[model samples]
Target: MLKKEAHYQEHHFLSSDYSKLMKDPQIDDAWQSDIDSLSPYLERLTMREQRWLIGHAIHDQPPHNIAAKYGVSTETVKGWRKNAIKKLRNM
Candidate 1:
């Protein structure tokens, strides 16, 4: 029963509101303004942080998945995100 409940929850979450914006090209520009606003701050991030952010935020990949891909630990990927946000905040 627990397994069935978990599967249902996972399916519901995945099926709902996933890629609602990018799936339709007409709405692709919806985020352009936000992107433009954040681009300057993003440029201040190191290339490593930028890559991690692109994978974690833009691509919606989990830190564990990114960590596995890069052969690093999940905490390290999360650290990159934390430090990147701190830098942006300080700026």
Candidate 2:
């Protein structure tokens, strides 16, 4: 998950040397569509579960760090993530 969010955050006009691939409007639209599709599933998760997913996916925070912040074991954090993903999949 390291730098995965950073990759998504990169934009065409924001860079001095533009990425030709990101220049395509369809690529940007597809990315937005993917994000939009997750909204309903995300809404169904508990706040704790949502925080864990967003922290891992977008902030690149490791499970250990998230566990520490939430005062739970790393395994518990992992379990929460698994269950949250399962719920999202079932949705």
Candidate 3:
């Protein structure tokens, strides 16, 4: 598991960027639609899982760094990111 402080920092970083990106009307609409379409799959994820996916996607973080932050192996983070991409493609 990630340490509490690490998790808090990650969330803070992601939330700030998310807020800025969502202010763009074009990006915001597309993002909201994508989220709505993927709602079922997203709902199945835990809060931490959702945060990880969002953070990775929005920030374009490398798998290794994401794995370190999330306390998972790089392979595991890669798998989750791949799965998220697949889900988004289907949506």
Q: Candidate 1, residue 34: CA error in Å? A: 8.7
Tens digit of lDDT per residue, candidate 2, span 1-91?
5587555443112222223322434335645455355556555665556657656764578999989977999998898798788887897
Lowest summed lDDT over 10 consecutive residues: which window, candidate 1? 13-22
Task: Enumerate residue pairs that collide in model 2.
Answer: none
User: Per-residue lDDT for 1-91 in model 1, tens only?
Assistant: 7999966653342322333322434324655565455556656665446546656655578999878877999998888888888887898
- Looking at model 1, residue 64 earns an lDDT score of 92
In order of listing, the candidates' clash counts read 0, 0, 0
> Model 2, poorest ten-residue lDDT window?
10-19
Preferred candidate (TM-score higher): 2 or 3 = 2
Model 2 segments more than 4 A misplaced: 1-38
Q: Which stretches of candidate 3 lie over 4 Å from their true place?
A: 1-49
Give lDDT: candidate 2, residue 82. Answer: 87
Global local distance difference test of model 2: 0.62
User: Which model is ahead, 1 or 2, in terms of lDDT?
Assistant: 1
TM-score of each: 0.54, 0.54, 0.44
Query: TM-score rank, highest first?
Result: 2, 1, 3
